[model samples]
Target: MGLGFGFKGRIVACAMSSLLATIAAPVWAAADIVIGQVAPLTGVIAGTGDEYVAGAHAYFAHVNAKGGVNGRKIRVVVKDDGYKPDQTLALTKEMIAQDNPVALFGFVGTANVLSLVKNKVLSDAGIALLAPYTGSLDLREPMNPNIFHIRASYTDETAKMVEHLHTIGIRKFAVMYQDDAFGKSGLAGAESALAKLGLKAVATGSYDRTKPEEVGAAIKAIEPASPEAIIMVSVNKASSAFIKQLRAAGSRAQLYSISVVNFKELLKNAGEEIVRGVGIAQVMPFPYTPATPVVREFQGLMQQYAPGKVISYASMESFVAAKVLVEALRRAGPEPTREKVLAALEAVRDYDVGGFKIGFGPNNRIGSRFVDITVIGRDGKLLK
Candidate 1:
């Protein structure tokens, strides 16, 4: 069974209420800051959501241990939305109404995030929506002021992969993507990127995320296209299955993937031999690099909080999101309000956290768009 927060909330509430009564003090002062998070703690995408939540919690724990932001402790109220759009909308509404958190952070999926964005709740309420895990084009284009993205868009990752492929003289391309909004967006972006080089995908295939059997069939159909390379825009599990099937079919075309498929799970499931020579695009610095201070700190935190887990691009993105939120909270100061916090976040320009610098302006909501491409080596590691 999935863990629910209601029981924990009641216990915390009772203890806080009792402490306040005993001390004759208010439970929350005007300066108290609370951030809300809605993620799929249970369901198909739970693993992704759990990584984000864990990173956010670990960052706040560090901040709180160091006396917090301007003497105010940060409280994150997380709810499970199961990666469902309807549940995300409902739970987000509840967070705003009941918890009255200053902002929303770490929402899980593209459809779910887009659903909340469509309702205009974040803009209307002047709340910050930070570092949503999805790389959908909708989040970056025609941007909303309230949503600050720390991760690169799928468009950015796809474009980078296409550029790298072109550099390697692989002209003819094909795409295999999950048939959803994410897939369509990725397809559109890849087409546009290829157009820049006066080229386009020779073939395209898609699979429904609900059906795993269809993925292998789709790959089989696309293999006949005989393109120079195949770009996979999919999650880890589906991507692994597709690669395994493609290898089984004796397809030797170069395999390329967006960051979603560039995960430890993919490497583990598909093995080094299967993933060797595969190219993957990333939006964040490689997790194994210890030269950068931010990377070093993140490594230490991961070791202390989530040891034995191989760090991936998503984990780095989650860490960056936590840093951005902490920066906003610090700028908002002790007597922070929702409006003030949002304004503070908007004011972030060339702000450096350790070594990573992020900037957010009035015209732009996304702080970073830089991406790097890496390939899986024979040792089963992504190397630049």
Candidate 2:
């Protein structure tokens, strides 16, 4: 009986010790799924980048509130490269090393994106890049496998604009462009699209990308041509200065621009009367009304996640991109690696996010070609 009692005491003591140790152990929560972005959060085009990142965050926030993707919350880690190419490359490498991000999203400039491609940043890291803001053809063609473009290319946007102008019998075209890879890409597209219709730009003008106000040379070249239409392949600041000066120079040509120019900014900077009737290409759907289910959801999420923020096409594009990224993450299964996400992205075919259709494959990376045109009406509002 004594031996039995001693054995029982030993067993009880062992059990108690085990239980105490288990109770004392720290409970560690699951780590967040980190995504990274390098964009111009400061500089000339800073507003566009801020809107883009905010849109992505709004979607991610919505997803996180619903328990996130596969039980892991998504977190975006961002670094500002200030729209500089060298800084973009360096910061991207830094992000990859520090954050171990599954993918990168919403890089803002043409030169910046091209720098990433040229240096094989995405390929070397074996990561995917989603929805870079610029639409340069160089990024699209020769198909870098690591990059997945969500928005239409500059080539596509320019083709739509040129084709529309030609269809309306508006000949005698003039071209005004920013002196950079972005501007040159748009110029080439405009020229190519015009060539297909047997038309050519009667005059072409260019301004330094950094100094948008120094458009004296471009104006001198283009204004005197007396073209019926002018395709302004530049961003908001440069375009605003050019339009104001061109009008001041007594040129009455109808102005058209690529998707990069924010119409609201134009209205604010150049005034409603000066910007009235300016045609701008749009890659995303209208963000104001519930024209599509995707847009409706975007509006709700924006209000919920980021209340009182101005809704613009730039932000909407990033929002669409975030939704697509979430879908890819879902398809990648519970534990997603960079490789799995890339495969999932490639496998996406006609996947509808609410109402917008996104399709991709092994050979095709550009997700959507849905381009529309909106004009700044006399009242400083975008009109269809």
Candidate 3:
């Protein structure tokens, strides 16, 4: 009887040990914080998407290598939406179903963000949406509680362009924009800024992205009006085409473009000689400027992660977005919940990360509103 009781006690001890192992396994496993991103990875706007993703990944890799955020590893899942609204919605839904990420980061286009906003997924999920590439007024105006924008709005860029144009004695202006929400938002901002100066656009032209070849005709139509400057509210590809057509047509008007026109791509498309003397409004400081601490750190990271590539405002914005998210996560403390993260972000005030200062409150979702004008010199450099 004593031998049988000892055998049963040993069996009960083994069962208890097995139960404890099962109970503690999950607790011992590494906690993961997933971040979802949707961008135009393989379509017309793929170049922009590439820059954004590169910057974001570089930041994430740097953070992960340094023990991650409060011991929780960050996993970034990027999906290609081809810069289309319907496709973006599908991709976003897939992210929610598969990853259920803590937040959405680096979504590329205005139309894509608009689609998500229309669907109300950000609010429903109570997930933080950060640093969407576009600066559409819709993102700022409606004040979506969960969505936070780190870049300057198109309105801010337009106002700065108009102010600089006025300084340069450019009263007569013609506008060329893509016939979409992003372009329309730019046009509206330009109109509003012009109104402030008691001026108006003398000639206006619009083109659909589907037919970029028609952009030359749009420029031709605007040129006949003989405005002193042409303000282009199109993306990089269309802007390049317009520049080529304008130069070929000998339209000698000064050209000013929104920040969407990638200066590097423009130089490639319409050679340095052709794109010389073009003016652009930049929301962030020049990425190559190693004078600022933030710029130096960004340059270092880019060298480490994405070597030999020119950094642009878009890339810097991506970096700043990552910095802001990391800072919010740090402030959220150990074992962070979604509510803690949101509260931490709301508590952020005058938070300076490198050169950019970000401030978000209960009433303010737009973080930065600063803008500067930079001109492309004859040597293919953006001169401030």
Q: What TM-scores do the predictions have?
A: 0.89, 0.94, 0.92
- In angstroms, the error of model 1 at 54 is 1.8
What's the CA error at residue 36 for candidate 2, in Å?
0.7
Q: In model 2, which runs have C-alpha deviations exceeding 4 angstroms?
A: 1-28
* All-Cα superposition RMSD per candidate: 8.9, 3.7, 3.4
lDDT of 1: 0.82
Off by over 4 Å in 3: 1-27, 308-310
Order candidates by lDDT, high to low: 2, 3, 1
**Over the stretch 1-384, how does candidate 3's per-residue lDDT look in tens digits?**
454547788899899999999997885756788889998987877888888888877788889889899988788999998888899998998898788787788998888898988998777778888888988897788788888888888988888888888997889988899888898899999999999999999999988876654796687679788888888888888888898888787788888888877888889888998899898888776887787888898888988977865588778878888889888988988766667777788788888988679999999888888787888887788888
Candidate 2's residue-wise lDDT over 50-134, tens digit each? 8888888889999999999998899899999888899999999999998899888889999998998889889999999988998
lDDT of each: 0.82, 0.89, 0.84
Clashes of 1: 0
Q: Candidate 2 vs candidate 3: which has greater lDDT?
A: 2
* TM-score of candidate 2 against the unseen true structure: 0.94
